[model samples]
Target: MNTEKFLELLVEELELENPLTLASNLKELEEWDSMTAMLLIGVVSNEFGKTLSAEDIKELTTVQSLVDKIGAQQFS
Candidate 1:
């Protein structure tokens, strides 16, 4: 998927009204919390077929980082 679609999915899933960029800090988002983190793990696995460990997820600080963990090659 492309970056636009990825961002759209995140916004839709998280019910975010603000826009998110690749550099957006995940921890800074109001919608980002422990529950959202868990949701992200499932989203990545189910949508991208990429498995993210708790440690890996913890290391994700930015949207780009999560995209990287999901496999950058998976995006255009």
Candidate 2:
């Protein structure tokens, strides 16, 4: 996916007031709760056709990490 679309989806999923910029930390968001975590996992899986567990989602602390994971899957 393109970076703009990714950021837009991230912003929508996390319910961020500000537009998501590059290298934004997911943990920094006050709305980053368990429900949001689950939503992110679902979004990534659905968008990329990759399965991710809750533990895997928990491991991704930053937006960069999440983008890396998606890119890695794209190449794999």
Candidate 3:
């Protein structure tokens, strides 16, 4: 995914208060709920055609980690 597209999706999914970065900690977000988690899963699966497991969700901590999990291959 292009970085801009990814960031656009992130903004939509996360409803972030401030600008996001790879270093942004998800735990700090006020809207980080199970619904948000599901949205993220949907975004990855829909955009990249990869399903993320529960364990995969638990392992994610930051924006960079999500980009890493999706992998460079998923991006153009």
Candidate 4:
């Protein structure tokens, strides 16, 4: 998927009022939590065919970090 579609899906899945950008801080998001992290892990696995450990999730400080984990090449 492209970055735009990824961000759009993330906004919907995370149930955020505000749209997410690559620069969006994960810590600053009110919807971000353990459940959210788990959700993200699942999304990456299912959508991008990648696995993210809890440690990896903890290190994700921004949307771009997660995107990087999923792989920059995974996006258009």
Q: By lDDT, who's the top model here?
A: 4
**Residue 56 error, candidate 2, Å:** 1.3
Write down the lDDT that model 3 would get: 0.82
User: Model 3 clash pairs?
Assistant: 1-75
- Sort by TM-score, best first: what order? 4, 1, 3, 2
The residue-by-residue lDDT of candidate 4 on 3-65, one tens digit each, is: 999999988887889999999998889888889888888888889789999899888888898
What tens digits encode model 1's per-residue C-alpha lDDT throughout 1-76? Answer: 8999999888888778799999999989988888888887887888888888989977989999988777788998
Give a tens-digit lDDT track for model 2, residues 1-76: 6777788987887687877766777878877788888888888888888778877787887777887877854532
Q: Give the TM-score of candidate 4.
A: 0.93
Query: What would the TM-score be for candidate 2 when compared with the true structure?
Result: 0.82
Q: Cα deviation of 8 in candidate 4 (Å)?
A: 0.2
**Per-model CA lDDT versus the true structure:** 0.87, 0.78, 0.82, 0.88
Report, for all candidates in order, the number of backbone clashes.
Answer: 0, 0, 1, 0
lDDT of 4: 0.88
Best by TM-score: 4
57, model 4: CA deviation in Å?
Answer: 0.6
Better candidate by lDDT, 1 or 4: 4
Which has the higher lDDT value, candidate number 2 or candidate number 3?
A: 3
For candidate 2, give the lDDT.
0.78
Candidate 3 colliding pairs, count: 1
